[model samples]
Target chain A: MLGTWSDGPTKSAIVDFVGRVTTEGPNYVVPEERVAVFDNDGTLWCEKPIYIQLDFIVRRLAEKAAADGSLADQQPYKAAVAGDLQWFGGAITKHYQGNDTDLKVLAGGIMSLHASMTVDDHAALVGKFYAEANHPTLGRPYLNCTYTPMVELLRYLETNGFTCYIVSGGGRDFMRPVTSQIYGIPPERVVGTAQNLKFEGADGHGELLIQPALDVFDDGPEKPVRIWSRIGRRPILSAGNSNGDDEMLHYSGKPGAAAMRLVVLHDDGEREFDYTAGAERILDHADQFGWTVVSMKNDWTTVFGD
Target chain B: MLGTWSDGPTKSAIVDFVGRVTTEGPNYVVPEERVAVFDNDGTLWCEKPIYIQLDFIVRRLAEKAAADGSLADQQPYKAAVAGDLQWFGGAITKHYQGNDTDLKVLAGGIMSLHASMTVDDHAALVGKFYAEANHPTLGRPYLNCTYTPMVELLRYLETNGFTCYIVSGGGRDFMRPVTSQIYGIPPERVVGTAQNLKFEGADGHGELLIQPALDVFDDGPEKPVRIWSRIGRRPILSAGNSNGDDEMLHYSGKPGAAAMRLVVLHDDGEREFDYTAGAERILDHADQFGWTVVSMKNDWTTVFGD
Candidate 1:
């Protein structure tokens, strides 16, 4: 049997709309061209004081700096290890300046750092990191901080024949390596920020070059543009937790027969990180634009994996 | 019910291995990793003296040149319209060389080439070209020249839960426009040669920048290497019709609990083009490989769509 919606006015309204557009029940509809896109970071998971991936990158950078004398002298590298995250955050881009050295050196360094390890080993490292890490403000296990209601929304759309894709500003490949297992969305269906890679043969085996420098950051407006180019179609439904996904929701809400754009409002202080203002990532846009505002506080009975 | 394979020395060996590895009656069923990779042109469909995509490019060039005088003076552009198949063919790479035109330009050019036309229009144009154009030697409709048995083989593997991907030397996006409908595979799952694409836009709605050059060509050893990079794992089953796919087959055949590589041998004369002895693509590495050879002459059945 299909699962019931954990009751509430906001949840009921959103679920009812999704149900109408899905390929079954009363509405039993949607054009064959219908598509849906979702943002990954705060909308899909938890991004409070800082994005989880940025933390991973900082950690990776710290390890590299400790091992490599040359890297230790670098601005972001040195700062990352010293726990000076402010300097390490997006500051590496300024340091790289005009040359391709940052990307080349960083990606190469990162690959060499973990290239020899098998898939199992990589998973274990990630698992250990997640277990020990804590969000600065929330002071909770990072892994247990995902937005549960948004996940169910994703499932509802998919069940209705919507081709759901994760379009985020985070690393595309990194998200792909684990999203399918975690969210039931396959790697091919996920698109996000990417590092350039090249093909080569190493030690009598084929390998790909994973560059460290940023390629495309699927943030804000870039979200919708990348969606059109990569997906070749506009999505009929879109959901996001912040301003990073604004363009995506706008694109999805483009003039069409039927469309839906939802902004997940973090109103639940007890269950999840509650924020009233967040630099226009989510709250500001919700009031300005007439989009479905899902109140995490009132709409969800659960916020993370139980 | 499982389909029957003719009793043969080689066939028996392959079937026995699969039988032992499957769920119903299995010894060691390696679950969730049954990846299969395929070579699109010549293997999945038909590629004779020239590729189908080349014709599309040439036609598009002709149309573009007709509209823009700048293109007419171009070496490749001039050669294309004059019906100088040889000169035009030789300039295939040159057309894409250093042409850092943005996605909008590339997409606009592509969409405009056959603008406002229905799917049938596109299909008919392709069919008309295939019907009239003559291969360098085969002298039959390109579509009529496909390997019949191979199509069955493709579906056969898919039925067994093998996720088949088209890993070919052809343009990845070019094939994506049509292959899924024709071959029953989705666009996201297909991987092939690519031109560099740039993302642009406040919301990522920028045009796809097709560099006037090839970004990556999925051919020769690059086939298997690209497959691993894109898919992040080696295929358990592989099929190819030429030396271009030899690396892929070899990679698939590498010792695992159960692995299989099948090579399609174009040996039929009366039913289709039979020129294996001098076939430049598949013959080069035929002697060194230990793959299951599906002989067109000996293999049961038809050769093309009736």
Candidate 2:
């Protein structure tokens, strides 16, 4: 089913887990409990040059800075105006290194980008950007940046009994607009960091306004908590490419069946970006837990595919 | 399909909405966007004697007060120890009257009941309570308290290619364990008030501990916001029984297709408690918006049915 995947242990592990649970035996899991969660960036799509959401929000902040002198003085806004991907990348790298002082500024900037607008308006803005924008490094439409093998894996699982969900650390509203078209996952199945929404009922009409507040930063340890809160059952299979997904791997369906944990390693600088700055911890656990790690350079015959 | 419902405007409205949307025409909605959201308490089951979650939590607090003298001295805990349903009822009644000073205190007590415990522990407690507990006034097992007509309605909609979800102001974990068996709604489809969870990964095991804080109260205006956040699509059909559900009905699919908003009015004094203290605002909304008001006294031939 996963035609883009090379014949390897990583693909075999996924097949083995699906077969064990779907077959009639002790390891058999009911169809109702077959939950599959996936991280959006890096795992599903390209995040190396920068996360797509970051790029979208930066262009927005940069435009605002060009008009407003006050906004131009801000650190991230200044960085945004200059198109300094390294500064944003460093903030993320510092966060994985257990320092979030600069990451908080980055998060605040992201939140401010959508505050005070209706969800529909924000969704339309994101829709416009996704349609017109292209990956800076890949020179391809943002929607086509999703990994070929991963998309095949998602379709293959759904072809069986698994209901796949995108549980990214990106903004929930940011991902909701395009997820259905790109990943074949519906908006209801996408879980991510959220902004507080306030219902404004005035002049005899009700509209929900986005509040400027951080609802949940759904990364790292928060992933497991949010997954359990959104979907009460544990996931039978999970996939990710960074340390942020470590807790989710541990929280997969356990003690009763064989759970598959797929970790994708970007080691093909020729085809895709190669770096392991934020994935050290997850890589260690992959070895310790005997999880199947997919070498992007070797496991796939192609990078992006339909 | 809705056999329990007598031939009335309410039943006709539901049938008409479903027919217009499911059939191929200018008014037709695709099956993927046919979302239905339902309020858990009062709408699906009896909430007259008390909300089931309140009953469960108060009993736990009363037991704690029996041993802890400090707990017995507190206002709500003392009321819990004394089995004063009036105090809890009054608190709910006042909140609907635009006063939540006492409701906040009551909410604090509710949150504290699950604080510091793992989600699995809390779910197990709820499971045990639902198994053995009976409605204080209805004199039936808590699991069997669901309204027969509502169950038929849920099943009817599902039979017509609709995805049903339970969105409530009650605790998410509290409603999740039993919604599947009682309402044919799975845990993943149940959205409600949430407690922040802490991921405690120690001793080679990961457990989610419930933090003593209210994350989001899925009531009143928050209903529309939570509904959008969880589902990302406006519901074409919504059912509720209180003021908290008014916004949900307003937020139902609009500007394009026929939307069905079912407001259940408990006015059967013989078979159920007749009260409009908390439902006054919603009753006014039903009239103003031309929403269908399902009178339990006239619409149903039976209240609780399998």
Candidate 3:
């Protein structure tokens, strides 16, 4: 089923792991326990140049600035449109210094951009964005930049009775609009960061309005936290690429469970961007934790469908 | 499939709704959008003679008091053991009066009963509790006290490609241990209230410890908030019995969707306890909102498996 994966150790390990869990092997897991979780950004799709959700946010901010000139005076919005790294660096420093008011304001602005809109309306808008948005470096549609091998692996897992979930750090609403179309995973199975929601309108005519402020920031440790809180089961298999996913991978690969963790190393600069960036720590953790590190250059026969 | 459901409007409506969603009917819902959510308490299982979780908490508190006499001296603990309704009423009234410290302390005590235990250990404890615990009046094990007709409905929905989820007010961890065994719903599909979790021990050798405070209180309007946050989709069908589920049922039965809402009414005093303590508001909401009300005396042929 993972035809895009080359005949290598990574492919062999994945197949062996699946066989051990699905067949009557020593490590056979029950069908109910066959839960596989994947990180969305770099593991399942390309996150190079910038994360896709950030790109979407920037585009939305620009659109808002265009409609209302007052938004152009906003610090983060102004800095974001001009691609000022210094502003982001200062914001990060402030965040580290325990002054997260600016960060919250920025996040609130980004979140509230679509506040009061029904979830379906927001999803339609996101769908339209994905339809026209292209990867900055890849020059293909952003959705087309998803890893073919990973998509195949998702189908492979599902074929073996494993329920697949995308535990992304992206906005839950942002991902839900496209995940089912791209990865065949339903919206409910996709876990990510979310904002507050309110039910508006009268008794029989209400709509769930998405609020602007951050509710659950599902990144780093919160990924595992949300996974436990929402899914209510520890995944038997997990895959990720960046530092944000390290905790989730660690939680998946905890001792005493016949679990598998795979770290996708973006090494194929020709087919995809090859900068490690925030993923540097995971390489060390992968080695120490006996997690399979998939070298994208050698292990993947195809990078993306495009 | 709903063998225990009598040939009533409730069962017919459910069957017709499933047929419309599954077959090429006018309201044929796509398989991806076939999400069904059920409330665990009175909707799926027996919630009479107090909620099952509360009974478990009181039992655990008693066990703790036996081990340490100091806990017996605690106000809420002492009040709880004596089944003093006045104490609870005062605490609730205080909560309504904006001083929720007492409520928090009681909840903290309830949550902390299984604190520091690994997920597996806690699940095992809950499983043992269910194995030995019998319904106070029914004399059968709590697991067997689940609604036979509702279990059949769950199976029927699954058979028609509907993904069923339990959106319970019970503890997520508590329901996970028995949901699969009793309802054929896996732990990952069960969403409920949870506490903060901490990863204990060294890297690669840690267990996720359930903390002793509230994280997501999956009740009332929070139900829809959680459904949107975690599931990332609106359920097409929802079932619940209490006023706490009013918003969720409303969210499910939005204007533009072909949705169904079923409210279970416990009016079968002979087979099961008859009361509408917290669900009276829902009964009125059902009449006003065109929601189906399943009368326990008329709609169900068998109340429980026992």
The candidates, ranked best first by DockQ, are 2, 3, 1
Which one wins on TM-score? 2
Instruction: Give Cα distance to truth, residue B209, candidate 2, Å.
Output: 1.1
Question: Tens digit of lDDT per residue, candidate 1, span A100-214?
Answer: 4454444444455555443334545766676687777665666666666666777777766778888987767667666766678776567787654444442223334454444
Off by over 4 Å in 2: A202-205, A255-257, B202-204
lDDT of 3: 0.82
Runs of candidate 3 with Cα error greater than 4 angstroms are A83-105, B83-102
Per-residue lDDT of A305 in model 1 = 66
Clashes of 2: 0
Task: Give Cα distance to truth, residue B33, candidate 1, Å.
Answer: 1.9
For all candidates, state DockQ relative to the true structure.
0.24, 0.57, 0.54
Chain B TM-score by candidate, in order shown: 0.73, 0.97, 0.92
**For model 3, which pairs clash?**
none
Better of 1 and 3 by DockQ: 3
> How large is the interface RMSD of each prediction?
5.1, 2.3, 2.1
lDDT of 2 by residue, A1-306 (tens): 899888887777778889999999888988889999999899999997888988898899898788788987787898998888899988988988999988889878777777889888998999999989998888789999999889889999998899999888888989999888988999999999888888876322467788878877889899999889888988888998899988888787664456888889999999889988899988988888777799999999999864
